[model samples]
Target: MIARIWHGRTRVDDFERYSDFLIERAIPDYKNTEGFIKLVFLRKKTEKEAHFTLITFWKDIDAIKKFAGEDYEKAKYYEEDRKFLLEFEENVEHYDVFAEEYA
Candidate 1:
């Protein structure tokens, strides 16, 4: 498995709206894309910003490419993101999944 990780932030006050945006819009888009295994959105609230990390799991690099296109390393954005995100990240980090355990 491959993990595609992206970090982003929103103003503390807009946190809930941003989370809703992710669920209503982003998640659907991800589901429509090829090779999407799962998505987890983590949020941490601070005085200045609400930090968010989107961890997406894919079957493999090829599956990521299907969603991310030829330049899968490049962070892709949608029109809705501009409303919530303070800055658009240039790149996303990827890691190979070694192992996992669940109850």
Candidate 2:
């Protein structure tokens, strides 16, 4: 499995709204892609901004390329994201999952 990690930040006031958008839109959008395994969405609010990290699991690099296009390292953004994010990061990091388990 491959784990793709992306990070973003928005104003503190937009935290809940951003989270809602992910639940309502982004999650569903990713689910439709082939080889989608699951998503681990994370967030934190500081004095100035709300940070979000999206870790999406896929079957392999090909599966990621399907969603991310041939340049899989580039970060993917949605239209609605413009309303929330402070800046767009250039790339995402992918890791080969060696081991994972849930208790």
Among these predictions, the greatest lDDT belongs to: 2
Report the lDDT tens digits of candidate 2 across residue range 37-103: 9999999999989999999999999999989899999999999999999999999999999999889
Worst 10 residues of 2 by lDDT: 24-33
The lDDT for every candidate, in the order shown, is: 0.91, 0.96
Model 1: per-residue Cα lDDT over 1-103, one tens digit each: 9999999999999999999988998899889978899989899999899999999999999999988888999897889888889999999999999998899
In candidate 1, which residue pairs get closer than 3 Å at backbone N, Cα or C atoms, i.e. clash? none
What TM-score does candidate 1 get on C-alpha atoms? 0.95
Query: lDDT, candidate 2, residue 58?
Result: 98
Count clashing pairs, candidate 2: 0
